[model samples]
Target: MAALRKAIQELKQLKEQCVEEQGVEMAALRETNQELQQQKQRCVEEKDKELAALLKENKTLKQEKQRCVEEKDAKTAALQKTNQELKQQKDRCAEEKAVKIAALRERNQELTQLKEHCVKEEAKMAALQTKNQELKQQKSRCVEEKDAEMAALLKENQTLKQEKERCVVEEVKVDKKEDVEVKVEPEVRHDVKMNALEIEQKLLRGNIEELNMKYGKLLKIHEKDKAEMAALRKTNQHLKQLKEPCVEEKDAEMAALQKTNQELKQEKLRFLEVKHFEIVVLHERNHELQQQKERCVEEKDAEIVASHERNQELEQQKERCVEEKDAEIVALHERNQELEQQKERCVEEKDAEIVALHERNQELEQQKERCVEEKDAEIVASHERNQELEQQKERCVEEKDAEIVALHERNQELEQQKERCVEEKDAEIVALHERNQELEQQKERCVEEKDAEIVALHERNLELEQQKERCVEEKDAEIVALHERNQELEQQKERCVEEKDAEIVALHERNQELEQQKERCVEEKDAEIAALLKKQLKKPPKALCVVKEELVEVKVELEVEQEVRVDQPEQTNEPIPTTQRRTTPRWRRVINSFYCIRPNVNDD
Candidate 1:
């Protein structure tokens, strides 16, 4: 009985210790459960914060994308407007160029007509000068003949005076001889001398009449020469008037040509100015476009950086959440290990207590013969209490197992959520990379287009330069041709002046020759009159009259011959046809080449 009591006391002490241990374990389990719940709440809050941040970043990205798109659209519109303006400017320039070209063509045609008129006028002037030269020659010859006749008449008068003096001397001699011969045959000799003297006087009067007629003819010829000189002077005045008008017209045409040239130069300068302005505008536009592109690139880079930063932030948050969850999971695992260890210790304690109870039961059975019934009743009640405590422990273990299963399911769900978040982040990163690639491709395309445009502009500039060079060359050729024409005109004027001077010198020389001829003819006529007077002294008075009439007829014949010579120049001065075949074709070719060149330049 004492042993039973001792065993019962020990059992009571062991039960008390086990109950205290169970209570401590229950407190630890409750604390762990509370800590797990708090950790789960913190994880849920962090997840919520992260989700909110992600949503905000996504919204910001969308807004930035929309803004970028709007900016791009605006830039494109501006570029289109600039292009349209450039096209309009180009069209205006083309129209202006065409107008200028047409005007130049008309000017060229007018110049060509003026050139033709000038050539015709020059040819007419040359013909008129030749005719005037021929007329001058005829007039000079007529004047020469008149001078010779005048000299002859003067010589004849001198011969007649000498003849009268000789006749007076002969009459005195005849008187002296007749006084001496009067005794021989006075009546017959006196009658013969008187009759002979009378006949000689009559012949002298006839010669005087012939000389008067020749003087009258010479006076008439002199009058005609003066009239011819007056006509030649009038013709010269008319030619001078005509030449003055022609010179004035030439000057006007030259001034017009110069004006046209000035206008062309002004137009060229204006065109150059316009081209320069266009180039400057193009450069400005290019600069603006480049600036806009740079700004866009900067914006895109900023957006990309922001996205990268945001992604990094999300990744960091995810890492932090994962770390935190891992820590929580590790803590839960540690708590579970600790709970399992406590449960095993509790089970070991229960097993040791059961073994002790079995030993005690054996000892009690051996000692039961000496024990009382009250002790048995007490032992049965204690055993029932132990069984109830074991049942409660089992219930607690089942509840802990259920809690562990729930925690395991929650951790699995969190893992799935973390995996889904990782997948979503990866997908978003991939999308961002694709968007970046597309943007880069678009930039490349734009750059290529710009390069192509620049190349085209360069080619256009080259073509314009070539056209400008060709135009300069044409202008130079035209200038050279104009200079050559001016030189030719100057040379022609010099030639005409020289010809006029030579004609004047020739006229003076002919006048001198005619004066000499007139002096010689006067001497010869005096000699002939002296011989005729001597012959008449031996011949009949009727024969002397016949000789006088024949001399008059010869003078008339000479005058008629001079008139026939003067009319001969008219037949040689027939109008000649002008040939402009070479100049016409050359001008036509030049115009055709210009037309061809213009179209080719425009095409380029």
Candidate 2:
């Protein structure tokens, strides 16, 4: 740029020197007529030579201007291409950022879903824990109830053993009383009474045999019930044992899931942090790009202003050249006028020389006119080149402005997207909170139901205990009444021996009626025992079948749960409501135990 400026200054100086030299030559021509003609010839030759040199300079100047304009056009074209490429890159970057942002949004949504799943799993775990605690309590209660029942059974066994010993002693006493009664009988009636006594003894023996058979059957039924109970206990224990390991495994899996969740949370945090950093970097980059654009625009504006100054300078130079041409022409015309007057003064003596000089002058004037026309055309061409450069610069500026506007719009869209994402997250959080509250409510209701069921079981146990005590009292009263009757009969027999002959017929009638009553009572007891035995036989199999079915269902459910776990490793299905359902089997076992024990005690 400095070299070009220096060249323009030199050209200006040369043009000024040419103009001064032309003026000096014309002034000398005006001073002397004889010298004027020869000086005019010299001046004309020098002016022609100067005009040729000026034309060469103008051509060189035009060539330099053309080269400068071409270089500027090439630079502008290359800058525009670069700007186009940058805009494309910016557009691509914006598209990529949007795509990446959408992908991140999807990832965030997936993470939120995972988090919600984790929360639900945690809720399930909590429910399971509560269920497990309830089951443990139920197991403990069952065990305690079993222990109490066993103890009661043992006590009943001891009482039965004592009752058996008492009954054996009473039977021996009764045999002694019978011997005394037999010995005291009147001799006249001894044979007939012996026959009757023998018949009665035979009948009593048959009744005893039937009672023994029934007792044995009842014992067998009781043993079977015991065996069934033991089996149920074993199965219950087995189920619990299996559950323990499975529960442990579930706990371990839950822990692993929690760890994975934590890792995911950390990863999400890191990703968010990274994304935030990237956004910050992008903002910084945008700011830097803006600054760079501002600098480029300033530079372009400066370049345009410089181009305008160059155009003005070019116009001034063209005007100066035109003024210089006109001055030279005026000087030539004045010289011609002087020459014409001189020609007239020396007419007849040198007419040919004068005419030849006029012809030469005309040719020189034609050459000057040709040179001026060429220069004007060249000036016009340079002006057009400047205009083109200015237009190209304006286009580059407009394109840059459009890119900036597009960038701004893209940024606004991104910000709106961010706001929407935040709002969605807030809504999701609110939904999760509501879900958690619902789970809490469910848990509380479950606990209340369990407590209520426990109270009902306690009341049932108390009722059973009361019934057992009432049955014991009734059996004791009957035994006492039977013993009193036996003593009264012995007293009456002693009196009958003393008052014999008169009361003999009445006593025989009373004895026959008592024997008939004994037979009827034995038949009724046998019928009642048979009915009880049948009932006991009917009940246990149904209970056992139900228990077995329940166990099978539990095992099936466990398998299903395991399959669900395997299929969806990242998610968990809700556990079954076993807290309530599991109690059924335990209560069934309790009822079965009660049933098994009740019949034996009642039979005694």
Candidate 3:
């Protein structure tokens, strides 16, 4: 019994020791649990702080991202605007090239017309020169013949003048003889011839009256003839003077015509030079256009590369965000598991020490509530950041619209410049025509003056002939000279007329040639226009392909973003235990309202 009692006492001691060890174990577990709870609380607080910091950082990142996105969108818009401007500039350049081609064609036509005009003018001038030479020979022959005729007439006039002087001397002797006869007769007829004498006296008085009337008539006739001869000589001299002036003017006009022709040739040369310049400019422009096309193609390739790289970057960022979200969700799941394990351990420990365990659980729950509130605040900040990004996108679109407007204005200015250039060309053509007409009028005036001079020379020849009757040798010589001069003038006039006819023929031929040249130029212009149109037809398809590719990239990016958002809820884990975390009636109602309202917002 003593041994059994000793064994029982040892057993009781061992049992008490086991109970003490169990208490120590429980105390240790409680201490560990308390430490774990504190650690969980600290972790929760740290997590909350980290989450708050993350939320704040995310808000800042979102704001920065919004700003970056706005800037990127602005850059994209600017690029698009630049692209649009480039396309417009290309189109304008193409139009300008077409216009230039048209202008060149017109210029070629004008040059051809000018060339034909020059050819006709040269032909006319040659014909005029031939006619002038022919007429000059005729005029020289006529002058020589007239000079011979004048010499003969002057000799005859000198003989007649000498005869008239001799007749005057003979008349004086007759008057003396008649006086002697009258004295002898008067003595014989003293008585018988007294009546006869009265009759004779009456006859003498009648004879005297008749002689006086005849003398007056002769004097008037001679004076009239002298005046007519003087007038004719003056007219002839005036005509000769006029003829000389006409010849001088004709020479001047010929020189002027030559100058004008030279000017026309210069104009043709200038036009040719301009055409060459235009061709060079066109070649340069074509090369530039080709370069521009290459640049556009390169830019398109770069844009495509950039788009692809951006897509890659966006995909990487999305993947990273998704992974981070997944990691966060996994962490939440691990935390929930840890919380469940702690709760299980606490429940088991609480069965042994219920009062202290309940108080500790209450403290843990209060800490959890504070962490959850902080998390909610962080979520609200993320939502606000998303709204800011959307506003930035809208602003970017507005900027793009503004850029488009600016490009349109620039295009309008280019069109106005084109119109002004056309107007200036028209004015230049008008001025050239006016100048040509003025030159023609001056030529007509010169011809009229020459004709007037010829008429005056004819009158001068008559005056010299009449004057030759009074003065013998001197008058005859002067008449001969005047007649020869008149003949020379007449010949000169005929020569000039022939020259003018030839000149007119040359002008007509030149005009016809000009017309042919114009036609050729027109044909060339038409060909150029056709070429430009054909080139324009080739450009549209390439631009469309580029635009289509950009649209496809945008579509793909949108779809990926949509998919990421759609998978967000399903991929996330439940962090709170449903049994332990009962939904507040107010929160449940608010959640229900939020779901209904959110769908309505989505629909709107």
Q: Residue-wise lDDT of candidate 3 within 127-154, one digit each (tens)?
A: 4445446655765675576567557656
1-604 in candidate 2: lDDT tens per residue?
A: 9999999999999989998898888777566545645655675686577568667757865675565456445644554465456547545544644554454344344434434433433443344455446656765676676567667656766775686687568657756776777766546455765576577567656755665675666567567656755765574465457447645754664576467557745854775475457546655754553354344344445554554475467558657856875785576568556755654555444433443543354353455356446644643563464455446534644665576566566556645654664576578568657865765685576557556656877899889879988997898798889879988998898788767754555455545664575467446535643554455554566654664465456446545644553443224233436674455443234334434543333434
Identify the runs in model 1 with alpha carbons over 4 angstroms from their true place. 1-67, 119-123, 126-134, 153-285, 297-604
State which candidate has the highest TM-score.
1
RMSD of 1: 79.7
lDDT for model 2 = 0.56
Which candidate, 1 or 3, would have the higher TM-score against the true structure? 1
Taking all chains together, each candidate's TM-score versus the true structure is: 0.35, 0.29, 0.25
> 510 in model 1: Cα distance from truth in Å?
99
> Which model is ahead, 2 or 3, in terms of lDDT?
2
CA lDDT for candidate 3: 0.55
lDDT of 1 at 62: 72
* Local accuracy by lDDT, each model: 0.61, 0.56, 0.55
- Enumerate clash totals for all models, in the order shown: 1, 0, 14
